[model samples]
Target: MAQAGTAKQPNILFITVDQMRFDCLSIAGHPIVETPNLDELARTGVRFDRAYTATPSCIPARAAIFTGQSPAHHGRTGYEDCVPWRYEETMPGELAKAGYHTQCVGKMHVYPARSLLGFHNVVMHDGYLHHNRMRHNVAAKDHFDQVDDYLVWLRQQVPSADLVDLGLDCNASTVARPWELPERLHPTNWVVSESIDFLRRRDPSKPFFLWMSFVRPHPPFDPPQAFLDLYKDAEIPEPPVGDWAMQEDPMQLGLNPVTDKGLVPKRRLKQAMAAYYALITHLDHQIGRFLQVLNEYGEMNNTIIIFTSDHGEMLGDHHMFRKAVPYEGSARIPFILNDPGNRLGLKRGAVRNEVIELRDIMPTVLDAAGARIPDAVDGRSILELARAGSASPDRQQDASLDSAVQGWRPHLHGEHAYGHLSNHWLTNGKEKYIWFSQTGQEQYFNLEKDPLELHNAVNDAEYADCIVHWRQQLIEELKAREEGYSDGEQLIAGIAPRSTLSFLKA
Candidate 1:
C-alpha cells in the first residue's frame, strides 16, 4: 500500500448522482431497474445498505458531502438556492493541500455558478437551474451560456440544440420523455465524455481527486429512447402508499404537477417510473464507459472509487414527489466504496448496515487519500469499520454485536424543512422514529420487518419504549438549536424553519 503524502498515493474517483433512490439498483433487489455496472462495483467493494442524507435535498445534502459537516453545522437545512458556499474546509480543498490535483466534471451546485471550491479546474453543468435561467439577459453571470460548459459544447455540436427544447420542466413536472436529440449528445453522455477527456489531460505527477457528478434521474425524467425501451416490458412496482399517507382528496393535489404530495393517475405514475429507471440504467452504462477508460489507462487497480448520491427521489412514495421529506425514499441513499488495491483492506462484497450519511464522505475519501481530515469536519472516518470486515450474521438479531465495531454512532438524526412535510427523524438502520416539526405528528417504523415503511407503528404499545428513546434523542439533538424546536423537555411544533441558519447568513 502507498503511504499517505507519498508520490504513490492512489487516485480517488468520487461519483454522485442526483435524486436516485436507495432501492433502485437491481443489485439491491429492485424489481425493475437493472444496474449491472453498479452491481459489479458493489461486488468488488463495500456497500453500506443504510446510507442516508440528513437534509435530503440538492444544496444542503451537497453541503454535507463537501464540507464534512452536519446540516446544523453547515446551516443549510432545506432546499434553497443562491446561498453562497463559504466553507473554508472542503473535500477538494483539503485533498489539493495534500498535493493531489482535483478536478470536477459535472454539477457543483455551488453559488457564483463557477466557484471551483478548491478544484484546480471545473467543467460545469448543474442541469437547468432556474436561478440561472431566470436571468433575462443572455450574458448574465448565472446564465446557461456563462456557466454550463455542456450547453456550450452542445451548441457547438448542434447549432440549434437547446436543453429545454423538449418542453419539460426540470423539477416541477413528473412528465416522461426520451431524449429528443441524438443519444450521444445527451447530458449524461456529455458528463462521461468530459470526464474521459479530463483523465487524458490530468497531471501525471500528482495523485488526482476527480468528482464526476451527474445531474440526472432528478427531473425532466428523460432518458435515451433505447434505455426507455429496456424497461418497457418490465414489471415496475407501484409506489407503496403508507397507511398514514392516504389523501382526503387525492385529485385536488394530484392535478398540480409541482405538488409535493398527491395521487396522480396510475398511467402517468408508471410512465414516470419507467423514465426514472431508464435514466438510472443509462447512467449506469455511462459509468461503465468511464470504468473501461480507467482500465485502459491502467489506473483501475491503483484507484479508490466511491459511489453515492446527494439524496433520494420520493417518486410518489407515501404520495410524496421530489425530496425534503424525512421518509425512507427521500432520505436513504446508496453508498458503495471500492478500494481495488486493498490499501484499506476493506472486505469485498461486504454489505454493511451501519447508519452512514453524506458528512462521512469527506472523511472517508480523505482517509483513503492519506490526507488530513479537517478539524472542522463533524464526521468520523469509516475506514476502521471497513477494515473490520462485515458484521456477523447474528449481529442483526442481537444488540450485543454492536460492540464488535467501535466508534460507530448508535443512530443517525435526519431532518428537512418542507412546510407540512418538514420532519426530524432518528434511526439505527433497524427502526426509525419521526416527529413532524410543523404538526407534532409522530411515526415509528420497524425497518427490519417493513423496509417499505408501509405501516406506521408509533402508537403500538409493543414499541412504546423505543418511541420514547428516539424522541428523547431528537430532543437532545435540537436543544442547542436557535429555532427552539425543543425546550430541553420535549419538541415544540409550529417553529418556522429557515433554509439557511443565521450563523451562515452572517
Candidate 2:
C-alpha cells in the first residue's frame, strides 16, 4: 500500500446495490442464490459477516456511506425524496482533493436529481423515483431528459422505451417478469457498460475513484430470460414466518401487490423469490464482466474493490416485503472488501464478526487512498481490524490496533422513521434489540441461534438482562436527539416520525 504522503495512490472501485439482502450471496451460505463472481471476490479479500446499514433505506443509508457519519449526524433517518443533499465533506470529495479522479456511474439518488455530491462527473439513473416522475408541479430540470443519462441513451436505442414500460411499480410492486428488451440494454448491463467506457476514457495520469451503483434486486423483479430460467425448476424455500408475525385470518394476508407486510400466496411468493434471486445472479455475472475489463486495463491488481448494499430487502421475511424495518433481513447488508494487491497485508478470505455499518465506508476508502479523514467524520477505518483479524486476546499485542479495537462500540444503534413501523435497534452483530416507537413494542433476537430471526425472545427470562442492557444503551443513544425519544430515564413513545430531522431541513 502507498504511504499517506506518497505520490502514487490506489484506485478505489466502490460498488453499491439497492435493497439486496445479506443472505442472498452464495458465499454467505445462502441456499438458493448463486453468486460465483461475488464468492470469488470474498475469497480473495475480507467479507464482513455482520455488516449493517444504520438507516435501512436508500436516501439515508447512502447518506451514511458518502458522509462517514451516523444517522443522527447526517440527519436522515428514513427514506425520503426531494431533500437537498448538503454536506461539506464526502468520500469522493475527499478523494478528489487528494488528487484522485472521481466518477460515479449509476444511481446517485440525491435531490435536484443532478446533485453530484462530489464526483467530477456522474452518469445518473435513479430508477423510478416518484418525485422525479411526477407530472404535476415538476420542474423541467427534474424531467427525465434533463437528469437521467440512461433514459436519454435508452430513448436513442428504442424511441418509446422507458423504465416503467414493463408495468412494474419500482417500490410498491413485486411482480416478476423477464426483461422485454435486449439484455444489453437492461439497466444492470448499462451500469457496467458505462463504467467500462469511463475506464477507457479516463486520464491515465491520476488514480481514479469510480462508484458503480446498481439499482436492481430492489423491485420490479425483472431479470433477463436467461437468468430467470436458471431458477425455473429449482425448489425455492418458503420465507421464514415468525410466530410473532403469523396472521390468523386469511383475509389479513395481503392481497395487494403494494403491501409492505402480510403473507402472499405461496406460488406468487415463490415466483417473487425466484425473480429476486435471478436478478442477483444477473448482477453477479455483470460484475464478473466488469472485473474482466478492469484486469484487461491492468488496474485490477492495483485497485481496491469494495462491494456493499445501501440496505436490504425484506423479501417476505417475517411477512415484511420492503425495508425501513429494524429486522435483520432489512437492516443487515453484504459487505466485501477486496484488496487484490494485498496492500494492507489483510487476511484474505477472513470473515470478521465485528459489527460494522455504512458510515465506515468513507473512512475505509480514505484510509486505502492514504488521504486524510476529516475531523467531522464519525466512522473509523476497519483496516486495523482486517490486519489483526479480530480484537481477540492473541491479536491485541499491537497497542494501537488494540486501542482502536477496544474503542470500537460494543453495539451499533440503527433506526428508520417509517411511521407506524418506525423503530430503533441495538446490535453487536450476534444479538439484536428492537423497540418500535409508535407502539413501544419490543423484540429481542439471539442472532447466533436464530439467524433468520424466526423467534422473538423478548419475553424469555434467558435474555431479560441482555434486553435491559441494550435498552439502556439505546436510551443513551437517543436522549440527546431533538425528537425526545428518550428522556434520559426511559423511552417516550408516540412521537411522530420525521424522515429528515430539523437540522437537515434547515
Please give each candidate's TM-score: 0.96, 0.96
Candidate 1's C-alpha runs over 4 A off are 1-5, 136-141, 247-251, 392-404
Q: Can you give the lDDT of residue 431 in candidate 2?
A: 92
With a 3 Å backbone cut-off (N, CA, C), the pairs that clash in candidate 1 are none
Candidate 1, after superposition: displacement of residue 434 in Å? 1.1
lDDT, residue 134, model 1: 75
Encode model 1's per-residue lDDT on 228-297: one tens digit a residue: 9998777878888889887565367866766677778778778888999999999999999999999999
Residues 1-506, model 2: lDDT tens digits: 45543446888999999999999989889988999999999998889889999999999998998899999999998888777889999999998888888999999888777877889999988888776777674543486657889999999999978888988878753468889999999999999999999999997888999999999988889999999999987898878888788665476645678778776777777878899999999999999999999999999988999999999988888878889898888999999999998777777877777899999999999999999899988888988777765444445344455655777868899999998889999999889999999999999999989988888999999999999998899889999999999999899999998899989878
Cα-based lDDT for every prediction: 0.87, 0.88
Model 1 whole-model lDDT (C-alpha atoms): 0.87
Clash count per candidate: 0, 0
Cα lDDT over the full model 2: 0.88
